[model samples]
Target: MSVNPVVRISKVLSLLTVTLLVLAGVSACGTSSDSTQDTITIGASLSLKGDFSDSGLGLKKGYELWADNINKSGGLLGKQIKIDILDDGGTPAQVTTNINTLIHNHKDSLVLGEVITGLAIPGFETADRYGYAYISPGGLTGKITAAEKDDNKHNVFGISLPIKSYLSSFDQYVLSLPADQKPQTVAFMGSQSPFATQQLAFSKAEIGDKLKVVLDAGGSYPEETTDYTPMAQQVVNSKADIVVLGSGSSAEAGAFIKAFKQQHYNPKALIATGGPDEGKAFLDAVGGADTAEGVFVPNSGWYPQIKNYQNDVFTKSYVAKYGGTADEIASDTVQGYAAGQVLEQAVKKANSFDNAKLQDVLKSASFDTVQGPVQFDETDHTNKVAIPFLFQWLSGHLQAVYPANEAQANPEYPKKTW
Candidate 1:
């Protein structure tokens, strides 16, 4: 018991070394098996607040509904799926930060896209930096697609139709009209936002010399401009046969509609880039079903009637969960759900959680969603299979009225006066 101090210290050190080796063995065993992992997390950064909040919330519902359905079906790859959504406040910088945290800190298995092109671009760039694929509900701007071509970054994919072609269907419908019914003068008014301006440009190019330009004021107002009465008054003054508004939201379109009504200026046709496609929100903004009637909005895909992949199931599930009729469902919600549908198919096809494998499957496969068949272009990653259609409000319902094959109803020309 009273042995030399040096010998006692040597015995204690030997015991400590043996204990460390035993603990290290346990750690190694756990690491090799990775048995504790039980869930696959998908993350998204959305403009849940700020300018895009309304659309952002719609997209959120879509994502949530998809995750709920997947979980109910026994989850993906035999593991429960969890979604981590963060609000970007409609800011690009915030989107970048949220994306990094999701990919690096949370170690999310996949990342979904934002609501608009401005917010989505940053999110896509950040995801690309980490070698992750970016699948968005919207954000089909030319810059993003061009970047994909010029930079060879085939990682960004859009669920919606390309921005430049959004109004192409409408143009074709107008040009096909009889000489007497054809509109002679056209007016273009839009926000400077990339999506709005691009649609305006495309409409002009497509219409060409067939229509005289009464007002070429597209991109005349800043995106943040709240008051549209002044610009709308100019359109009324021009006495244009047709008024094409490139609105960013239902509210913007509603403002213009209200102004036109006040001035008692009813053009032969009044169509907007957005707004009327938003269902109840658009109707409410334009002062109920009566005012909404005859308003036209181009649709990339997805109407309540189209029998696309799992659309019936999606519509029922959405109504059951959100308490709305199928017609009242926001198009943004469909876009969001379609984005998830793409991701789910890619994961199942690859049979692995690896981002690289998912990207490869996405590039080669054509997946069906509520928005119809989605096949991304190898170069731009934009959906190439879905055809854009023109939709108009008829008897309080948004009906596809163009592209004879896809038309749910005939075009309501020379729309009713407000």
Candidate 2:
């Protein structure tokens, strides 16, 4: 049965051709599906190992929790999300490097997370240049977004209160207070950072003819200094009726309050903005619940004690997962969750992962999340209602004490003297 050599060779070539064609068909199908489907990837940069590490870790937890929930619900657009993150070490240069790595190396679709205000500019610049839509759950620098918008850089959105609105709104609330309760004189103190300075300027403008400034003491103390006694002494000497401290961090804010108390110079009201007044850390830093009495801070997130439909839902879920009350969770945690919510909603409304389309959805839509209604102004990307009621420390917990309807307890108007 031996065949001619040419005929045998011809038969072998035909079989090889058929086998190769079948293999090519299978390969093409696999490649097609891979190109069109799979997990969606997002990128984030945070100060996970440096000065702002606590809040940065909180933000990461919030993002992870949101991602887990979405995946459990069958994922977004039928694809699971993978968040690629990097620690920036809380430096502007490091932030810039991390952002570049995320955008260029990882080729991620979106950017999220928080960096300190002073260190965020480079990140903003990178997002703009690359045209990756970005949002932060915690950054509050109005000028960053405002400047970007002016230059036609519309890829950025900030979830926290805008610097302008944050200062003006607080002053507006003070002005709305009953005439007799309003303090005649005020003292302003804080880090001399750009955001703090802007806050002071805006508050001064809002309080025109309404209050007098006795001590404009701030920026005098370097951020590295732990002892705020020198600044506290100036504030005490001024005998200001009201004291407003715009601290850069919880530790600094707590130090200022402790120093003020140690000096036995308690003003009628001592209101503070920034990290220190937000949650448990500051209270603990200043020597526990008993010593933290009467301190007032804005209720930026709906705490567990607040009775609201949204608050109940978030509180229940958060407590069940983390085994702690709402106040125990870092304030930035809620913010990071809110940011993920906004991003998910935007993705759904747009029905596309295209940056331009997502940006359009963000600018036009209002999302109702655990924090409440989130609406952004397209011009500057400022949140319309980021900050809600003001809360005062009562007993060992924070209680809503303003707007009557939202008040959980009566406010200690004069803030008790130490």
Candidate 3:
């Protein structure tokens, strides 16, 4: 109907305003919804710099590898996976901050654990506060699991063997040796790191009485200590038959090894909680393979040749992507990939991206990864299905050598002189 020009103009303006408001609303909703529907973002804080940089970088590579593999083969739930990794600089405080920022920015993103236990603990706590599942690859200390028990933080899950049982296979193998071959005197040396300290405590309780305690320096020094000659001298002075070092990194282990070599102190057998299992990095840190000969380290069911879920693919992919032989692949890389595996399985099983739903699925489900089978204990969320193995540096490679059944090579006992 014909009307006044002024009235017609006012009505036209009103209609245009309403149309714009509806378009803005749809745009806002799409921005938020498309993020989740098109891509699943995962968050993690890693020690990409500082002391744990070597392992942290390896872990980052593994995470990226997993994401690449998933994206190439129809990503999780038909959506691409995006990993938002932040550098924690190997500090506990920064890890906490990184995790907080990650959760704050993307409330629905899942969290992957950090490299060291010290960093992972804070990361886990932050994720728990947000009620997000935290799947850790290298947080093996029992303290975290114990804290989870006390606080009932079932959101934290460890993909590696618990620290309490890290040395069980080594202990069993030593005890099974001939009476004369069995170490009669032992020394326990560990940095003040929770992972190392816990391993030291367990070692003392498990075999302290069986063997003469020559030196118990388990909690003698802080993890950041640069000089290890003093402690190495103590071990030499004690002249222990065997040395069990609760080292937390390849650098720490290398320091002690170099100190021992300088003093020409050689024990019948020397095993560390970490370091040697790091592959070529450990060998390089300790002055090549000859110097690392016969050293033992515990592994959480991962080796390049192990016949496990997609191990061949993972190894081949790692080599193709990183340009290194299978023997040089770091254990940290395997752990990181396994953590991704667990998360991928949980998402598919629940058929949901909700963190709460994924948590529930992880609690009761068993998953297989490059490492092996992973089934978390209902009470502690520690992996109970995978058995830790003792690996020794033999013929320039770290090979499994314990429990008779899993032995890839007979242990080179009475370790060769450095």
Off by over 4 Å in 2: 1-37, 168-170, 177-180, 222-225, 299-301, 305-310, 385-388
What lDDT score goes with residue 199 in model 1? 92
How far off is residue 345 in model 1, in Å? 0.5
Better of 1 and 3 by lDDT: 1
Off by over 4 Å in 3: 1-36, 106-108, 150-152
lDDT of 2: 0.72
Q: Which pairs in model 2 have colliding backbones?
A: none
Give the candidate order by descending lDDT: 1, 3, 2
**Tens digits of per-residue lDDT for model 1, 1-418:** 6899899899999999999988865443201121236787888998788888878988999999999999999988887778899999989999999998887777776888975878888888888877788898874888777756676676788877888898999999999999989999999999998889999999999895789998999999988899887899899999999988999889999999988888889999999998888999998998988888888999787799898899988999999999979999988899999999999999899887667777898888999898888888877878888798899999999999989998899999999988
Q: How well is each residue in 209-319 modelled by candidate 3, as lDDT tens digits?
A: 899998989989988887888888888899999999988778889988998888898998999998887778898889998899999998787788989999998999989
Q: Give the best candidate by lDDT.
A: 1
Per-residue error (Å), model 1, residue 183: 0.6
Model 1 Cα shift for residue 69 (angstroms): 0.8
Cα deviation at 165, candidate 3, in Å, is 0.4
Clashes of each: 0, 0, 0
lDDT of each: 0.86, 0.72, 0.85
Give Cα distance to truth, residue 23, candidate 1, Å: 21
